[model samples]
Target: MTDPNEVDFAHTDAADRKRREKATGLARYIWERDISGAELLDLPDAQLRKLAREAGVNPPSTRETWTVVAELLDEKSRWAAAHPGHPQATPTHSDEKIMWIKRPITPWT
Candidate 1:
């Protein structure tokens, strides 16, 4: 079945692609910098806000920033698959389920 969410992102509008790239860059900073755990608690409000913006997060509060981070990561993982009818990312459900494919299926699968 054709998934409605499926799209040839390579052919998508350039602006959208750029925005996604930017957002992902910001999301990476949060994880790659190793500040996710500490900043979520100890940082002052102003610095936290700055970090969030640099991470391309746009939300009213730090908690909401997580959603933006998630969106960027999710979008990034999607590109691993250039086509549909297969998983792009194993995103955690609200229950934090681990649902990603550990090993890719063979073409014969």
Candidate 2:
């Protein structure tokens, strides 16, 4: 029988592993699409607002693009700081092709 005082290292390790996995996934999603603060500025206002909502900044104080951009950048910086050592996946040609295929078809495309 296991002692009640014994700590479960396996459970602790598993939780840590899961957290790292999530962080790595976030890092990949950010890097793969080049979704940085500066790049976000090039996006349409509608898309910027959508991103703000997704970033948890609901009903941003102002509709100004810069405001939302700053908030999103701050959120990204905070996540990076919290998840140190998260893997940044290097995108290959195949990855680029897949991204191209998945990209939304715009009137300009």
Candidate 3:
């Protein structure tokens, strides 16, 4: 006989895990590409919601896509200001990208 509480807890845990995975995937997508605000605007609401979650914006369910994009960009700018040395903190210009390519890659432990 399984306890109902345990089953509910297990379901909640699974959902949380799934949400985390989606957020991670979205973050990776953003990091690997130079995505513009227009591109983000084209994304579905569900994807924007996931990106909002990853950006720590916590956009309301009733918010429009443009509103969410604005918030995400604002949060990204704040993060870049706070962590200027981080690789993905800001978008690199072509010259900067060349410089980045010339720099040696450090392996993470």
Best by TM-score: 3
Please report the TM-score between candidate 2 and the true structure: 0.31
lDDT-best of 2 and 3: 3
lDDT of each: 0.48, 0.48, 0.52
Against the true structure, candidate 1 reaches a TM-score of 0.30
Candidate 2 weakest ten by summed lDDT: 91-100
Give the per-residue lDDT of model 3 (tens digit) for 1-109: 8876565642477755654554444444443344544555656777666655655655435434344444455566677779989987756543422321234589999
Q: What is the TM-score of each candidate against the true structure?
A: 0.30, 0.31, 0.35
lDDT of 2 by residue, 4-98 (tens): 99997635878556544443443334344445555545556776455445434443333343434445555666676677677532322235433
Query: Which residue pairs in candidate 1 collide?
Result: none
Could you give candidate 1's per-residue lDDT for residues 58-103 as a string of tens digits? 5234343445555655454454345544453322231311111123
At residue 53, give the lDDT of candidate 2.
54
Cα lDDT for residue 94, candidate 3: 31
